[model samples]
Target: MKVLVTGAAGFIGSHVSLYLLERGDEVVGLDNLNDYYDVNLKLDRLKRVEQHKNSYNFSFVKVSVEDKEAMENLFEEHKFDKVVHLAAQAGVRYSLENPHAYIDANIVGFMNILEGCRHNQVKHLVYASSSSVYGANESMPFSVHDNVDHPVSLYAASKKANELMAHTYSHLFNLPTTGLRFFTVYGPWGRPDMALFLFTKAILEDKPIKVFNYGNHKRDFTYIDDIVEGIIRTLDHTAEANPEWSGKDPDPGTSKAPWRVYNIGNQSPVQLMEYIETLEDSLGKKAEKELLPLQMGDVPDTYADVEALVKDVDYRPQTTIQTGIGNFVDWYKDYFKVK
Candidate 1:
């Protein structure tokens, strides 16, 4: 299958692209190479993709999803069998500062992708949603079937909007769309803005790391490989209309059309302090600690109910936080040359 993976230079996107290429799929990776974090990291990820000399199934284009015209052109050019839409302006705290970026990238950009998929005869459109959508809900294990009307941050709101937009497209055009609500995805080549990266960096630098919510927060930190695996499984399993779905008691997770949502998480929520301790152990350095109140648009905890995902894909994320953080620390030390 030929796949078009947006945000291919990004942390998850880069990993997904390589996974697809490894599985003998021709992948066209697209990214604007935004400097939201560091363009150098994005370039380095792209370089890693280019380093695969055997399959040569990967190609990248410099483009942003917000540019509707360019996005349409790319879609028109490639008859993508599957689309993994992973690109977005992704930071809860940052969203509070810059809401328009979320609107443009997460909202407008997603609109363009839905349009493209609707018109281009794409088979399956698997997009990234977030655990942040479970904002303000103190549910022990967050499920896709739960109502997500309340979003704490603009980033979460945009993700919820993407799910709605995809549902609309699926209902209107019969597009097979699946939204994966990822929970705290982390691993090698991870985003610098994410908690794992920040904790690793601070520990290596011997700087104090801010433990949010007084270190009472818990997160279902998922590994990148697990996410990529789930994505690949979902991409192959096209969405189908739930025949039993009724408007009288509609399920939020499934639509009458070919649309579905699943939580791609490990189903294991670890304490923030435990995560810090794991990093400290991995790096052989104790991090200076500063307990801080939870910031705006931030949730105290995130625990994903991945039963549906497992039932659908016959797979569950197996990487523990310790292993995941250890891999990340090793990668960080090797990548940054932290002696």
Candidate 2:
């Protein structure tokens, strides 16, 4: 199958692209290579994909999803069989500082993707949502069936809006849209803005790492490989309308239209302190911690209920935090030449 992957140079995008290529799928990668964190890191990730197996099956283009003309042209030219829309302005705390970026990237960019998929007659549209959408809900394990109308952060709001927009398209055009609400994704080649990367960097440099929510926050840190596996399974299994769905008692996860949402996570929430300790063990260095209150637009905890995902797609998260962190530390040390 021929697939289009937005945010191809990003952390998850890069891995997803490689995974598709490895599975003998033709992939057209797209990314603006924005300096949200480090453009060099993005470039290196792309290089790694290009150097790996099935490199000939992968092609890349530089473009932003918000650019309507560019997106339209690409869609018309490529006519992708499916699309994995992972491109978005990501970061809960950063959304509070620069809200417009979220609007342009997450909102407008997603509009362009939906339009492209709708016109191109794409078979499946698997896009990334967020665990943040379950904002202010103290549910033990965040489930797709739960109402997510109350998102505390603009980032979360933008994701929720994407799900709504996707449902509209699925209803109107009979498009098959599947939204995966990802929990805290981490592993090798992760975003510098993410907790694992930040903590690792700070710890390596003997700097103090800020422990948010006074180290009380719990996160279901899903590994990158597990996430890619779930993504591939979802991409292959196109969404179908739930015949049991009724407007009288509509389910938030499934619709009468060909739209669905699922939580893609490890299904095990670990405390912030425990996560850092795992990292410390991986790096053989102790972190200097500065306990701090939770930042605006941040949730205290996120635990994903991936039962639907497992039942539907046979998705399973196999990596533990210790193993994931150890893999990350090895990659980090090798990539940065850390002794």
Candidate 3:
């Protein structure tokens, strides 16, 4: 299998590329190497992929998904058998600050990916969505079958739009598409903007970590390996039109076309304070507490009901915060040589 994995230099993308390459697949990894976070960290992640097992099978390209001409050319040149679209302008609160960035990278960039997949004879397209789409629903254990019409943040709105756009392509062009709504993914080599990374960094530096929602928020914090597993599983199981789907009672998760959406998350939701405590335990340090109100454009809780994913993929995310955060702390200390 020859796979094109966009955002290959990113945390999840790097891990996914390495996984595919290890399984004897030829992988073409693509990323713009933007400075949204640390470009050095992104470069280091790419190096890890290049040095890992079956590294020869991996080839990386410098490109952004929003660049239509470059994306089209790459698709035509590679003739990719499948695509894993992971590149996006992430960060819920960041979306509030810079809405235009979200529009460019999440919306326009996704459009370019869809066009590339459609024009090429790609077999299946698996892209990342977000748990934030369950915005304003106040529903416990967010389910894909439920309605997601309300999005509090522009980032969430972009994700919902991606689903609608994918459904259209699946229906009109017969393109098999699957969207995975990932929960709070965290692990070693995680993004700097994410909570795990920030908290760890602040704690090591003996700084006060801002506890949002007064440490009342709960999240289905899925591990990075679990997310890669879900991606591979869904990629192998090509999307197919649900025969029993009815227009009278439309299921938002499935369609008459070859389009489906699933939630990829740990079913176990952990409170923010518990998560912080786990991190403190892992790092052997305590964080100065600064309890803050729930930041705007953020959900109070996120719990993924991955029933559809389990039914289809026969897999579930099972990493506990203790092990996950411990692994991250070890990596952080080793990566930075922090005593």
Candidate 4:
């Protein structure tokens, strides 16, 4: 199969592309390489993907999904069997500073992806959605069937809008679309803006890490390998219309069309402080914590209910925080040539 992976230079996208390439799939990776966090890191990730021992028939293109002409041309040229749309302006706090970035990247970019998939007869469209969509719900274990109409940030709103847009395309064009609401995904080659990366870098450098929510926040910190596995499984298991779907009591996670949403998380929530402690243990160092109130567009906790994903894919993300942190630390030290 030929797969199109947008944001292929990104944290999860790079891993996903490598996984596909290893599985003997022809992969066309695309990324604009924007300076969201670090363009050098993005380039390094792509370089790693290119240099992977298992990589074969893998090629990358520098393109932005927001450009309709470029996207159209690429879709027309490749005619990809499947698309993993992971490109978006990521970060809740950053969305507050530059809301238009979210509009341009998450909204307009996703529009182009949907259009490309629709026109090119793509078999499956698997896109990245965020757990932040469950904003203000206060649910213990966030379920896919629950209402997600209230998003706290423009980033979350854009993701919710993507789900709605996917449903529309699924209903009208018979597109098989699946949205995976990812929790706090962390691992090797992770985003510098993410908690694990930031915390690890700060702690290693003897800098004080800002403990948000006063270290009270709990997150379902999922490993990247587990996420990539779930993505591959979901991509293989193309979404189908739910026979039992009812409009009277509609489920937000599924539709009568070939559309579905799943929360890909570890299911086990770890406290913020506990996560930091795990990282400290991994690095053989202690972090100087500066406890602070939670920032705007931030949630106190996130626990994903992945029962739907388990039932459908027969898989669950079981990577422990300790193990995940250890792997990340090893990667960080090796990548940065730190002692």
Q: After superposition, how far is residue 269 of candidate 2 from its true place, in Å?
A: 0.5
Query: Could you give candidate 1's per-residue lDDT for residues 213-303 as a string of tens digits?
Result: 9999988989999999999999999999999999999899987899999999999899988888888888888899999998988888899
Candidate 4 global Cα RMSD: 0.8
**Residues 140-244 of candidate 3: C-alpha lDDT, one tens digit per residue:** 889999999999999999999999999999999999999999999999899999988999899898899989999999999999999999999999999999999
Question: lDDT for every model?
Answer: 0.91, 0.94, 0.94, 0.95
User: Which portions of model 3 miss their true places by more than 4 Å?
Assistant: none
Question: What would you estimate as the lDDT of candidate 3?
Answer: 0.94
Clashes of 1: 0
Q: Which stretches of candidate 2 lie over 4 Å from their true place?
A: none
- Residue-level lDDT of model 4, residues 1-339, one tens digit each, is 999999999999999999998888999999999998889999999999999876768989999999999999999999999999999999999998999999999999999999999999999999999999999999789999999989999899999999999999999999999999999999999999998989989988899999988999999999999999999999999999999999999988898999999999999999998898888889999999999999999999999999999999999999998888899999999999999
